[model samples]
Target chain A: MVIVSVAMLILFCMIYLIPGDPAAVALGPRATDAMREGLRIKMGLDKPVWVQFWNFFFAAWQGDLGRDVLSDRLVATVVMEQLPYTLALIFGGISWSVALGIPLGCWAAVERGTMADRIVGVLSVAVIAVPSFVVAIYALLIFAVALRWLPAIGAGEPGDIGDQLVHLILPSLAVGLGWVGYIARMVRASMLEVLESQHIRTARAFGLPERMITYRYALTIAILPTVTLLGVGIGQMLSSAVFAEIVFARPGVGKLVYDAILTRNYPLVTGAVLVTTILFVLLNLLADLIVGALDPRVRSRL
Target chain B: MTVLSIKDLNVTFSTEGGRLHALKDVSFDVPERRIVGVVGESGCGKSTLINAILGLLADNGRVDAGSITFEGEDLTRLGPARMQELRGQRISTVFQDPMGALNPVLSVGRQMRNIQYRSGRSRSEKDARSEAMLRQVRIPDAQAALARYPHEFSGGMRQRVAIAMALMMRPALLIADEPTTALDATLEVATIELLRELQQDIACSVLFISHHLGVIAELCDDVVVMYAGEVVERGTTRQVFHTPRHPYARRLLECDPARQSGRTRHLPTIPGEIPDLRQRPPGCVFATRCDQRVDACDKVPPDVAVETGHVARCVLAEAR
Candidate 1:
């Protein structure tokens, strides 16, 4: 909770400190100097920085993020309108990463020092080395330009479920690319360490079947650290969504925040940042709970 | 009748440096319903022997030569599935560190129930059996312990839980790998006593491995003294302790601090460190430290009969 407050405070200061005038942007170059001054006071931009922060702090608590300077709409409403699309894209990305990453990691650990292990090691490294945006561009070219299997740009129309899903495919793949390498590597390392633990040897000595030994015994312990990684992976997806949304022309918080900053939309920028930070915090808390549930030693500590 | 017999066993471990011969021409037997103790210092192949017999040798280890026969079947030739079936059913192990032996994540009852999967019993029946086994090992609130995780138990209590789990299936042979080494002195003695009483009640043979000579002398009917991957002496506990024939065995007995009388300036110690397995001596593995070494000690000493059912691998014993 403290983290969220601190993050918002930092973001608020950085956004205002930038060389941009919200009142000037709202009134445009044609407006007279007296008109700009009047608008600055009306929007509270003429207030002291501390007073402005205090007002934002109180208003945010009540979910009143003020109005966007350009659109003159409530910033919260603007963010809420685009929230579902960003969330859907992130959900699909996380699901894809876990579904592919876990089995590949298990297979690599089980076949350590074998050809399969080497292939997985090399491929994951290559994937991590290439940035997510590069993967996005390649995905756009191959799937959209050449094969024409899916839409190339923009979020689908409202209330059209099939079109929304079709538009989500390329962007989700781009966001998921970064997570696949990170999660797979973590799972493989964790599995190898767990496999060598003495309790695993004890389980083997007890004559449990190979399946039980690997999945039931080793996997349970191995998956704990990976759970934490997946939490961090969600935050990565959020940041990556900024670029992904821009490339695909999707209606999302990422695009809203980017355009808000470019046009000096202070309320919109702060609202978007606050929502993303809270989501990240919640995801991490869930990860900790899952970890505590999986491991008795940690659970007792908690 | 012998319940388990190992003949001419040889185990080697391949490592980054080279192959290390861990065991050489070792042979012993556990008579039906009898306890046999294997005594040695650290790195004397005690764990290697146990792992080889259990078919749990590490990835780099191999049973290069030998046959481990239990009851009537050869374990080395058995397939993995058959070996797994035999394991925990006919041959169970109680490891030294109880905290490491039991999975901390699993409840005590759940871990015990896993072993009963092949018994074809229902979950509640397995739970009842686990409680009964815990009670057999003298754990307090046996029923409540079933719901607790392994970490909640104290060290001695965990060892008892381990013992209960090992004996749950009524295995024919129990291999205890210094199961009491990690406990306090009082707990150590109590755990050992519990082990003996329970072993008798179950009527199963035991192969006890420990580096502590006192533990071997107290519990073993037959004792095998191992030095540098080789069995230097084998005889009944009484025969070996009273009249040790091998020079190393004689020195080992002298090194026991309990045997020293009051006001001794220094307790006895064998002169040198145990030779590394990578550089085993040309003949007698203990010859480098033996006080009675002769020129012929450079050659492999044959097993010479020192008494009925007693043997010592030494040139001096051969001369006698």
Candidate 2:
């Protein structure tokens, strides 16, 4: 709740910080001063900044974020329309990253100091070092343009699950690839540490199969930090998804916010920021719950 | 008959400095249904001996030349599958830190069940056996205790649970590596007592390792005294504690606070450092620290059999 409020205030402050008049942006340079002033008063920009913020904050509490100045549609509706695409992209990215990262991590740790471990170490560092936007562009060029495999632009036709899924692959890859390296490196480091821990030794001492010890005993404990990283990674992925969306020309809340910022669409921008912040907080909460379930020590504390 | 026998064990670790002679020509036997304690200071290679026996030595460490014979099989030569099969069912271990020995995330029941993974028993049967073992170790509310995490238990209780898990399969041999060192003084005695009672109940041979001489003296039937990486003395607890033949053994016993006759400002300490194990010493490992060192002490000491069962690795023992 506190985070949402803070994010809301920051978003409002951002509206003021950016050098543009929504009325002028909406009416264009041809509009007279008298007409602009009338438009500003109607849009509540004529009121004190605090008053405008308080009115918005009060209305936001009741699920009212006004409407988009350009389209005159409810800000909530516009954000909601774009939310699913961003969400699908984020979730798809996270799923593949975890699938690839965890096993790679476990394998690296098990074969530590060997060629396999070294390869994973080098690859993970390399992937993590490269910026997501660069990956986004290259991925677009290769998978979408050069290879002619996936669609290069747009989010595909709406109401078609198959089309949406096909469109989701490259953007998800661009957003999630870095996280794969991040998760792999995190899991590997954590697994190495856990494997050295006394409990792991105890398991080995008891004559448990090496496979069981690695997966059941070591991985369970090693994966805790990775869970936390995923929560934070999602938020970062949402932001980075903007680059993928812009390059891929996909419709998403991130792209919506970026376009809104350009046109000085205050209601839409604030509404999208608020919704994503809430989503980030909720995802983190889920991660904490998962951690608690996995680790009884954490559960007991909770 | 011996339940576990380590003969001519030569374990070394590769470090940045050089190859560390952590254990050299070390040999001992854990006789059936007997408790043999190995006592030494930190870095005395007690842990290395345990790891070697369990075949869980660190990647850089190896058994260069050794025969760890458990039952009729040479364990050092056993394949990983065979070693794993023998573990928990035939040989089990209780580690030093009770808190660390058990997985914190798992319930006590879950870990105990895991210990019996090779049993091919039903889950309920394992749970029932785990509960019974907990009761044997005197953990209150044994059934409920199984569901609780290690952190929920006090240190002593956790150690008791560790003991229960170790003895659950009624392993023929149990290796306890300073299991009571992490507990409080009162709890340590209680844990030792519980271990002895459980050992007797299961009739398992135990190779217990500790630096605590008092604990060894109280609980062990036979005792091995180690200095640096080599065993300096071995005998019945009475023989070693009452009549330690090696100078290092005598100094170690004298350093025990309980053995000191009266109060003094200074605690008795052997006045020298352990020789660097990266380079194996040609002479007695403890020769530099021995107050009774003679010209012959500069040579590798012979194993002098003072009695039928008592042996001391010192030239003076033979002279005496």
Candidate 3:
């Protein structure tokens, strides 16, 4: 909750720090000076910064995030409109990362010092070193330009779930690629450590099959640390979606925030920031809950 | 009648500094249904001996010589897959730290069930067997304890739970690596006694490893005394305790505070550090700290027979 307040505080201050005339932007440069002044007064842009902030802060508690001066739409409406696209992108990204990362991590750890382990280690390091947007460019060149398998830009038919999924593929990859490398490396390191633990040695002594020991004993323990990384990945994924959405010309919460920031749309930007903060908090909470559920020792500690 | 036999076994670890001779030409046997204790101070390679038999040696540890035969199979030659089949079914192990031995993520019942997967019994039957084993280990409210995690149990209870899990399959031989070292004194005695009773009840041989001589004396039928990665003495517990032939063994017995007869201000301690495995001296490893060291101690010591089955590796033990 305090984080939410801080986010609001930062977002509220961003408008003043940025050099822009919202009234002139809304009325257009060609508008008469008297008309621009009239619009500024009507939109309460002439009010003191603290008074404007105070009004928005109190109204935000009641779910009123104010209206977009340009679109004349409610800030809440714009957020809700673009929220699903952002969420879907984040979900797609996380799924792809986890799907690829975990098994690769287990394989790398089990094959440590082997050719396969080295290859995976190298590939993961490479992916981690390269920025996601750079990877996004290559993905676009291959999948969109060369292969012609996917759309190059803009989200597909808005209400069509299949088109939306198709449109999200490249964007998700753009966001998820780095996370895959991160999660895979974390799982490998964690699995190696867990494999050396006494409990795992005990499990092996129990005459369990090699597969069972690897998956049941080692993987279960190893995956705990990875879950926390995934929680942090959520915030990274959300931010990455801003760039992905911009590159792909898809409108998401990130894209909405990006455009709002560019145009100095205070209400829309503030609303988006608050939502992202809440999502981040919720993701961390979910991670803690999962860890507690997985390990009774941690659960009792909690 | 040997349930587990290790003959001329040598294990070496290739560490960064040098080759560490962890176990040297070690030989021992756990007769059917008998508890043979392997007693030594820390770094004596007692745990390494157990790991060698169980094929749980660390990555760097290499069994350079000899064979470990369980029942009839040569364990050292067996592949990991085949050895795993024999492990827990024919040769289970109870580790030193019960808390560290059991998976923290799993419930006591779940882990027990995992071990019983090969039993091919129904889930309910496995549960019933688990409860029965817990009761056998004398855990009160065995059924309730099943749902509990390892951390929920007291240290003593955890050891019992570990014992119950280990003995559930009734392996032909059970290697207990200081299972009671972590417990308090009262718990230690009770756990040792319980382990003895359970061993008999299951009719399984136990190669019990511990540094605690008192526990070994009370629990073992036979004992092998080790020093610096080599067994210096081997005999029945009565024979070895009543007449420890090796200088190191005698000093070890003397160091036991329980054996003190009179009010002594300072307890007796063996002089000198345990010879480093990497730089073991010529002659006997214990000769440097031997109380009665002579010029003859510079030569390799011979294994001398004290009685029919009793043996000690010492120059003094050898008759002229």
Candidate 4:
């Protein structure tokens, strides 16, 4: 934990040293030296880079990210208010992918030579081959604009969670579809290897129900590797939700970071990136602990 | 009453390459409390025959023509769901390698209890029954094993768990496919001894598959010798082993590395590859490897009765 704090301090220093002026990037390059220097002082960018970094770090440690330059509100206020919409999509999207992909992948593995297996195999390959951007746009064009079934953008009336869900559907489907294919194919391969195992045959020999053999004996073992992949996929989703945020016009970290980057709001941009990196690391650590708990060998060792 | 009677059984498998004749016109009966040991080379379809009996053959494989009548119901005609019901309750199997035959994730107790519960016992009743069966199999630390997964148990201990699980429902027939193959010499002897003791206690018919003639010699009352998918000899263990009438059986017993008296038991080599299932010789699958093969052996499929209760599928045995 101590090492982590020290590492973060180093990372902050290194990030600040990147070429180009925050003042020039924040205001346009057309600004004179006097204007740049004056703005830098006000923003605390005129301080030694370490001082500016420490000022932001202390504020972040206190759970106050200062204010968004343009929004003129606390960054925490923006994030906490906006996070639910993104998280709803992330949670719903992941739940749908696992529920659908696991059984589908198991069936595909168990019935390898059948038409259903071949069709699913081909579809998984096809979905993965196509980019998430293409799927999101096409879905939005068809379901939102073309049919008018769903609102094309906006998280809906700020007070209504149900309306927010309706708004999130298209973008979630878009992101989930890309990852589902890769996950399904990987699960199928693992399931295939496990189903042929002698333990599975022994389970069959014992006259356990077909479902028991397929799920308890076979699928349970096959799912461990997929569980690990799901963790990696969650990280993938956050990084890639930029497209989703843009398409849905949702107020989330993705959009906030994009805007911050464009306007060269150095503190806000750095804060967003730093938060994302920390979240990514935390998610990985949490997944590792979950997997270790699920696996008896790891659990016992720990 | 007979527990399993397989008559004129033939199993064929369809592969991308061609039709594979995995089992050819094989027949045998496993009576109540009797032990039937099937000895053969690896590819001679012993495992396939056992799988066919269990109705667990691969998608491409099928019992092409056969009648497996167990108790009163013809197992060959039973629906899959019904077959599954019969499997654990009335018929169970002990697989070849204990390491490969047990689920690594499950505690031995859970695996044992699952079979009992699945076969219609209540959870509490199932737990009692499982513990009792483990004791019956003579597992010294069965209670501790119950908390541990397959990885924690030794190979021999794993086999004991398997045997206990197989006996959970007191199945009428137990198909043991090379159950000792994964164990060391001492454990092999010990496991078969435990199995012999099990046969006495529960009195269920056990069909043992093995490549070792020595094991069959020790355990089975009846021995079935198969070569290239065909049962070349079948008889009482005494008649078949001592007064072996079939030349293939003779050559097989001769090739038994651990059989002959004296230094290292002189493991004799059979001098030919076991014929491929997809490309078996027309008249005799073993004739290619037989030293005493005659033209008549090449032309005719041999089916000879050596005694009223014993049979040998060899033309020479019937010539007299």
Candidate 5:
């Protein structure tokens, strides 16, 4: 865990050392060369790059993300307020993946080579092959514009979480659709192998109903692999909030960092990056523990 | 009366490639209340023949040319909806692996009760009947075992559970396909004895499929030896083993080391694998594998009467 934190901290410093000047970017097109230089000196950006990087990380450690140069707002405060919205979007997407992926996988497995299974299988493969950003745009155009049922942007007020969730539907679907295909295929292959197993044949020989043989025996064996997917897949689904948040222009941490990087607000960018990296690392650790809980063989090793 | 009468039975599966014949021109009959063992090598169409009789063939599997007459009803012609009524009620099977024969996630009690109630048991009657059947299978700790999953039981216990499940329906005929091959020697004998005991009490006929002629020798009253998708011999177990006329049946018995009298370098083996169904030879399927091959062996062997109840598809036996 400490290694992960230190690794992220080192990466944070390296990104800041890149040659491009964020202060110059912040000053924008209309500013004179003398004025841009003056602003850079005032913000302490004129210092050696290493020194500037150090100060920014120090402020990040102290929770002093500094003010966004353009908005004149505290970066730390802005990010904290937006963090929940991104987390919500991520959770929503993962929930959607789990809700649809498991049952559909089992269904495809039980009804192997059937018309419905074939169609779902093909659709899932298509979902994975096409990028999520494309799915977001198409879904937004269809659901928000063509259908005209949802508000296009924003997480809305605290009390309006349901409406915010409604707005997130298309973007989350775009983000999560592909994982369903991957997880379903994993499940289907497992189910097919397990269904043909000796015990299953033995069960049927006993005159057990088809439903019991399918749901009870075949599905239990099939789910071992699906549970394995859930742990790491959830991390990927939750952490990959950038594209969807950016496309929708939602007030999420991803968009906050986007604004920070553009304005040369180093503290906010470093802080957000650190928090995200840590969250993902911790999420992966939690996944390992949870998946281990489901499979005793791993638990025994621990 | 014959419980199962399969006449000119043929099974063909049309896969993505082309038509593949699985069973061809096979015919046999099971007498009422008797153990009839179908012994053959793997892929000799033993399991396929039984699956066709059970109406449990997969999507691509088809009964290309045959009549499976069970108690006067042509099962091959019965619609799926009509077949379902008879499947768990009057027709049942026990397969190769006992552990797989029951649902891994369900309690044996639940599986037993489900077949009991859904096939027409009331909720109240389901429990009482389920417990009784558990005891009948001789599962120790019947109540606790009933509540446990299939994996919790030993292989022998599981097979007993499977046997109990099959007999719970009190079917007229039970088809078991290599049912104890996965068991240890001790469990194998115990399971076979358990099966015999159950069938003795239930008075149900058994169409037993296996590769072990020794098992058939001990368990079956009559035998049907299959080779390359057709029956090569059928007779009383005594007649088939002692004076087997068909070369394939005789070779099958000759290969069992327990029954071997000579210390030969190698066991007597039927030469080739079961012929590929896609390009079957024009003549007898077994002739390529038969050591008794002659010029006439290239011609289809007619089914010749060897005894009062014995019959064999062998050209050499005809001269006798």
Candidate 6:
């Protein structure tokens, strides 16, 4: 809650500092001076910056993020409509990354210094080195343009779950591919460390099968850092999702903010950023809670 | 009858320098229901010997030659599956640091149940067995203790839990690798007593390894002294302690703080380090450090039998 309020304040300040009058942007170049002045007063832009901030902050605290200048609709309603798409994309990216990353990490660790391990090592580094936007562009060109197997643009028909999921495949892949590298490397390093621990040796000494020792005994502890990484990864994915959303032409909170920023839609941009920050903070809290549950030493302190 | 016999075990580790002969011609036995202690300094290959017997040597280390024969089977030749099957069922181990040996994320009951993975018993029955073993180790409120994690207990109690888990299956042989070295003086004695009591109750042969000569004298029936990967001396605890034949074994005993009669500013210590294993000396391993070294000591010393069962690798063993 504290983080959300602070984020709102900072967003408001930054948007205010940006050189462009929202009134002029809304009115266009042919408007007379009288008309621009009238529009500025109506949009609450005539007040001092501090008063403008107070008004915006108070209204936002009461669940009102002011009205969009061009559309004349509530910013909160606009954000609510677009949030679900962005959330789905972020979650899909995270889900697939975890699905692919963990097993690859465990396999590489189990086969520590072999050809398979070397291949995974090289591939993970390659993916991480290439930015997500570059991946998004290349993926768009290959899958959508050249291969026309999937849809090229839009988030599909609004109410059709199957079409939206199909459209989601490419964007989520672009957003999540790099994270797969991050997660796999993290899991591999921690797994190797845990494998060297005395408890693992003791487990082997007691005659547990190699499979049980690797997956059950070692992985349970090794996956802790990866869980924490997932929380932070979601925040990073949100920024990457903007590129994915724009490249794929999907209607999401990130694309909404991107369009609003171009049109000087301060209310919409501030509201969307504040909401995403809140969600990120909550997701990190969830990660910490999961770690506490998994490790008893952490649980006792909690 | 021998519960476990290691015959001419030769193990080496490949390093950037060269292949380190970690254990060379090392051999010993744990007779039925007897406690055999291997005493040596830090780099004397005690751990390498244990790893060899358990087939748990590091990736760089390999058994160059040897056979660890237990019962009617050779452990060196056993496949991973068979070796795993024999581990907790036929042979278990208690490690030096109890906290490091038990998983911190798991409960005592969960780990105890896991150790009995081969039992093919139901969860409730396994829980019952775990409680029984904890009770045998004299852990207070053994039932409640099972639900607790390893860090929840004090150091001594955790060691007790490790012992309980190790002995739950009534293994034919138990390897205790410096199990008491991590505890304080009082806790060390208590842990040793608990281990002794548990061994007698379970009627299992124990292969104990430690540098504490007094602990060996108090607990073991026989002792083997290792120097630079070789078994320098072997005899009954009485014969070896009362009449040490090998110069290294004799020097090791003299350095024991418990054996000193008067207060002195300087503690007795063997003057030289163990020989570098990367290039094994052609002569006796202890010759450079031996105070009574003669011209003949420059060659490989013969294994001289000073008595019926007592043996020492030294030129002067027969004379001494």
Q: Which stretches of candidate 5 lie over 4 Å from their true place?
A: A1-83, A98-122, A183-224, A263-302, B15-19, B99-102, B105-110, B122-132, B262-265, B279-283, B291-298, B318-320
TM-score of 2: 0.96
lDDT of 5 by residue, A1-302 (tens): 67554865686667667667656777788888998889878777788966876776677667676776666688767778877877777777767776787778889887778998998799789877988778778878877889887766666656776777787787677677877788778878888898887666655544456777787667766777676666567556644577788887777877877777766666567667666666667666776786666444455568
lDDT of 2 at B80: 87
**Mind giving the per-residue lDDT tens digits that candidate 1 earns over A1-302?**
79988987998888888997888888899999999999989988888999999999889888898988888898889889988999998987888788888888888999999999999998889887878788888999999999999999988878899998999999998998877777788889999998988888777778888888888888888888989888877888898888889888888999999998888888889998898888889888988998999999999997
lDDT of 5 by residue, B114-214 (tens): 67754565865776777778899798877777767676677888888888888887999998889889998888898889889989898889999888777
Query: lDDT per residue, candidate 6, B170-217, as tens digits?
Result: 999999999999999899999999999999999999999999998999
lDDT of 2 by residue, B1-320 (tens): 99888888999999999899999888888899999999999999999998898888888999999799999899999998998888888899999998888988888999899988888999999999999999998999999998899999998898899889889889999999999888999999888888888888888999999999889989999999888889889989999998989998998898899887878888889998999999767888887777888898778888889987898999999633
User: What DockQ, on C-alphas, does every prediction get?
Assistant: 0.75, 0.82, 0.80, 0.67, 0.32, 0.87
What is each predicted model's overall lDDT from 0 to 1? 0.89, 0.90, 0.89, 0.81, 0.78, 0.91
Candidate 3 shows a clash count of 0
Q: Retained native contacts per candidate, as fractions?
A: 0.65, 0.82, 0.86, 0.72, 0.49, 0.89
Give per-residue CA lDDT, model 3, range A225-298, as digits (tens).
99988887798888888889888888889988998877877767788887788878888889989988988889
Q: Comparing candidate 3 with candidate 5, which one achieves the higher DockQ?
A: 3
For candidate 1, give the DockQ.
Answer: 0.75
Q: How many angstroms is the interface RMSD of candidate 2?
A: 0.8
lDDT of 6 by residue, A129-217 (tens): 98999999998899999999888778889899999999988899999999888888999999999999999999999999888889889
What level of docking quality does candidate 3 show? medium
Give per-residue CA lDDT, model 3, range B1-320, as digits (tens): 99888888999999988999999878877889999999998999988998899898988999999999888999999999899888888899999998799988889999999999899999999999999999999999999999999999988899899999899999999999999889999999899889889888889999999999999999999999999989899999998999889989999999999999989999999889888898878889898888899888888787888887688988889532
lDDT of 4: 0.81
Measured by lDDT, the strongest candidate is 6
Pairs of residues at least 3 apart in sequence or in different chains that clash in candidate 3: none
Worst 10 residues of 5 chain B by lDDT: B98-107
lDDT (Cα, 0-100) at B138 in candidate 6: 89
Report the C-alpha lDDT of model 4 over B243-316, residue by residue, as the tens digit.
89888898888877766677863477888888778887777777888888888777756688878657888777
Better of 2 and 6 by DockQ: 6
RMSD of 4: 3.2
- Model 6 chain A is weakest, by summed lDDT over 10 consecutive residues, at A1-10
State in Å the error of residue B147, model 5.
Answer: 4.0
